[model samples]
Target: TPTQAGHATIFPTGTSPGTSSVVNFAPGQTVANSAILRPGAGGQVTVHLETPMAAGTAHFLIDVSGWISTSGYEPRGARVETIEPVRIYDSDLSGGNLTGARKVSLQIRGAVSTDGGAAVVPPLDDVVGVIVNLTGVNAYGGSRPTHISLVPDDFDPNVPAQQPTTSNLNLVPGQTRANLAIVPVGDDGRIHLFTLQGETRAVVDVTGYLVRREDDTRGGRVIPLITPFRAFDTRLSDFHAQPLGPARAEPWSFEAFVNDVKVDGEPVGKQAGLLGNFTAVDLERPITWYSPVRTHMTIYPHPGGGGEDENCGAPPNISNVNLGEAEAVPNMALLRYGSSGMGPNRLCVFNLAGYVDYLLDVYAVVLTD
Candidate 1:
C-alpha cells in the first residue's frame, strides 16, 4: 500500500543497532516497537522504505514467543501488579469482528478471578512476561491495518512488520492508539493478540507481571544492546543547555530523571534490561519537517518525586524513535528491571511536545541476570 504516502523504517541490516528502530510505516499508517530482540543470527530483520513503494509489494511476518540465554540468563523475581487500566478484551463487548487473521486469548493466569477481582497475573506457575498497555481503539478500515502483533500464541503466525507489539502509528478512520508490549505468556497462561487487517477495538492493560523462580535454573536472556553509549548530553551540560524552551508558565513539556549517573567514582547500577536512545530537540521551532508529531520521549521509573502518576510503572518505555526537525532524533528506549523491592531502578523522561533537550545513550546493559 505504498504508491503514494510514504514512510517505513525497520532495522538491523548490519551493524546499526544503536538501539534498533524496529518498525515504522505510514501511508496506511502503522508502526511499532516494544524493544525486544535477541538476534545473534536467525532472527534477522531489515526494512527501510521511506518513499519507494512505487510498485509496492511488501508483506513480511515473523513471530516467536520465547528465547533467552545470557549464559542462561536467570532473572527470577519481579512481581508487580499495579492495575488501573484493566479491560482484557472487548471485540465489541464479545460479539467478534477482527477481520482477516485474528487470535485473542489474554487470560494471564486467574487474573484475580478472571479480570473482575483484578491483579494477580502470571502467578500460576511463576510466569515470565507481561507489561502491557496495548490499546487500539477506533480502528475500522478501508484497507487500514498498520500493525499489531503481541506474541505468544505458542508459536507460528508473525507479522511483526519487523518486530512490533503495538503500532497504529498513522492510524486513521477513527483513530485510537496505544503501544507498549513485552508479551510472552503462553504456557497456557495466555497472551496472543494478532491483527492482519483492521477491525480494531482492542485494549488490554495489565501493567506488570514477570516472575520465574521455582529454583530458576537460570534460563532467560536476550542481551542485544548492540553499540550505543552516550548517557546524557544537554548540549554537554553546564546547567541545562539552550534548547528546550516554551513553557513560559510551565506547560511546554519537561521532566528529567537521570539521577546519580557516574562511572569511575561510584554509582551506576540497575541492570536486567535496557537498550537506550532518547534524543529530542526543538532548538528552534522544528516539529514537522519530514513529518513527526507527538514530539516523543517518555521513559519511566523515577516516580521518586511524584506529584502523582504513580511513577507510571506499567505502560512505560515509549519512544519508537522519531523527532527530526532541528535534528537529533533518536528514540529507541526499552525497560525491564523492577524486582528487588520494586522501587528505584532509576530513569524518568517525559518531553511530550514542542521544545526538547535530552540525549540519553546506553546501548546495552544486562550485566548478568
Candidate 2:
C-alpha cells in the first residue's frame, strides 16, 4: 500500500517499543531505507510503520543485501574503523560521463589523492569492505530517474561486470543525490561503479573501512543490537518537540546498556563509535525562497551537554546528510567518539542553515577490544 506520507521503523523482535531505524516516504513515492539489524534468537526482526493516512493505505517491502556471521565453517567477522571523509574519485575531473552499462574502477587502499588531484585521508591495508557516500551528479539533465551500482572490482572494462539488481544510489534528473554504501572491495583493493541508465558523473567519498578483527587492532568490533534503538528525536513531545534552529548544535547522550545489552560486565560508558541512520526532516526555508536551498547536517562528538553556545565554534567539514526544503532524507553514518574530554556516548548535531528536525536510530556499537 502507498500513503500520502509515512514512516516505518525496524528493530529486533520482542524488544520494548522505541524508535529504531526509520524510513520516511512521500506521497505516491516508493522509497527504500536500509539499516543493519541483529535478529532475535529465532532470527526475526520487526517493522513498525506510522502514517497519517488510514492503516490499509500503506505497504512495505524488505530485502536482505548481505549478512555477518562467525559460526560458519569459514567464520567471517569484521570490525570497522572510521576515517575523515575523503574524496577518492570524481568522474567530472576526468572530463567524461559514467555512461550506461560501463564500469569505472577506483583504488581504495593507500590512496593519497583524489582523481582530481586533491589530498585525501589514506585508508589502511587489508580492507575487506568500505563505507562510502556515492553521489550521482545529474550531468544529463532531464526528468528521468536513474541509478548507480557499486560492484567488486574484479572484472575487466571490456568484459563489463554484471550490474547487480540492487542500486547504491537512486538519482532524479537535475538533482544531485548521495547515499551511503558499504561495498566489498576486490582482492586488489579496488571497487567498481556502474551506471544503469543515462549518462551521469559519479563521486565516491570514503568514510570508513572494515577489516578482520585479527588483521587490525586499531579499530572497533561491531556489536549489532538484537533490536535497533531510537537514540534521540527532536520531534517527539517528551524529547522536546522543537525544530533545531539555524546555526545551532545540540548534544544528546546515550547509555552503554540499551535494551539490557551491555558492552561488557561493567557499564562501559565510553565507546569507540556508533552505527546508525540519521534523518533530516521538515526543513524550513525563507518566505522569499525560490531555489532549492543547499543545507547540511553534521553530527560530531561534543564535549558537554545542554543549551546553545555561539562560541561552540565551526563544525568539521564532514556532513551526515545533504538536506532540501520539505524533503526527508536519511543516510547511514559511522561516527567515532572523541578521545579526550568528550562525554561518553554523547554526540552533537549541527545544522548548517534553516530550522530542521532530525532523528537518530542506532543499530550497532563499535567496541575497542
Candidate 3:
C-alpha cells in the first residue's frame, strides 16, 4: 500500500505523457531515489507510475544527470553516491529562467567529493560517467508543452529516446517536478541544461559516479541475450518454476551459468548481476489491468545451481530498486557474490504482493564470476 502518492520515471524521451505518474508521492523531507532508462517506441518512453493517484492530485518533478546504454559506456565504471547531496546549480538563488534553447552549464569536477578523498573532478575526470540529480522549480507551464533537456554539452539529446519523467509536465506557476536519469557527460566536464519551450529555474546535485576500474580481472562486463527467455514461469512444467498468484508472495530461484564470455575474453565467474525485464503475465500473455496496492519484486544473488540459499548473508546489498505491479518491470542490480566467486551459480526473485505472474528476459549480465 502507498504511504503517499507519487510517480516514477524508468526511462524517458522528449515530451510528457497524457496521464501518467513518475513518482510515488513523497513527504516534505528529502528522500533518496534513483532510476535507469528503459527505451520505448521511437526510443521515447513515458515515466513509469509506481502508485496510482486517487481523489486528490499532488505535484512532482524529475532530475536526470546520467544514463546507461550498451552502444557506448564507461568500462568497469561504478556508480557512487555523495556523502551529502551537493547542489551544483540553483536558478532561484542564481536568478533567471532559461528561455527557449538557452542552456546552463555547471563545472562538476571539483564541486563534490567522496569520503575516499576523491573529488568529483580529479578522480572522476577519466571516469566513463558520473551520476547526479537534475531538478527544476517553479517551472512555467502554459497551454503549450514545457520540455527540458539535460545532456552532456557534447552529446545531443537522443530524440528517439524515452523521457526522464512522464512527458508534458503541466506545472502550475511555481509548481515543481523532478525525476532521475543517468546520462553521459561531455568532454569539457560539465552538463548542459535546456528547455524546449517556456522558462524554468533548474538545479543540479551530485550523487555518485561510474568509473572504470584499473584491474579487469576483478571488474565487470555486460552480457546481453538476443531474445528474452522465460527462465522461470511459475505456471510451468517442473519442480522449479512455481506460480506466484495475486495477493501472494513467494521466492523463485533459477540458474544463470551458461559458459562465460568476456568482452576482453578473459576468465569470468567472480560475482555476477542480471539485467532483465520483469513481467507479470497470465498463462497466455495479454494486457492486464491493475488496482492500487504495493506490488514489488526483489532480485538477489543466491547459491548457483539450486533452491534459495537460507544462509545467503545479506544478498549483496545493491540498494533496493522499488518496483510496481506493472505488466513488466525492468531491473539492473549488482549481486554481491560470495567469495567462492567461481559461480554465484544461483539467483532468486521474490514477488512482494499482487497476483500477477512474472517473466524475466535477460538482456545482459555483468560478471566478475
Best by TM-score: 2
Worst 10 residues of 3 by lDDT: 313-322
Tens-digit lDDT track of model 1 for 173-210 = 55555565666677788877776665666656554556
If scored against the real structure, what TM-score would every candidate get?
0.29, 0.79, 0.42
The true-structure Cα RMSD of candidate 3 reads: 12.5
Can you tell me which runs of candidate 3 are displaced by over 4 Å? 1-123, 130-150, 154-182, 186-210, 213-218, 226-229, 238-271, 282-294, 301-326, 329-350
Clashing pairs in 1: 68-221, 231-361
RMSD to native, candidate 1: 20.0
lDDT per residue, candidate 2, 272-360, as tens digits? 77788888888886444555565788777654433533233456555667768888888778776542244355567889887899988
Comparing 2 and 3 on TM-score, the stronger one: 2
**Model 3 lDDT, residue 66, Cα:** 38
Cα lDDT tens digits for candidate 3, 1-369 = 234444454444454442222233443322323433445568665544444444333343545443445554445355332222345566765666765445566665565432235454454566545444455544355312455555665433344343233322223244444433354666777766665556676655554444555554434444443333345555556534555543233333333443543445664454344544444433221234544444444445443433433443333212123334332333333332221233334555554455445555444455552
lDDT, candidate 3, at 18: 24
Q: Rank the candidates by lDDT, best first.
A: 2, 1, 3
Q: Candidate 2: worst 10 consecutive residues by lDDT? A: 303-312
Candidate 1 wrong stretches, greater than 4 Å: 1-127, 131-178, 182-189, 194-211, 215-270, 275-319, 322-332, 335-369
The candidate maximizing lDDT is 2
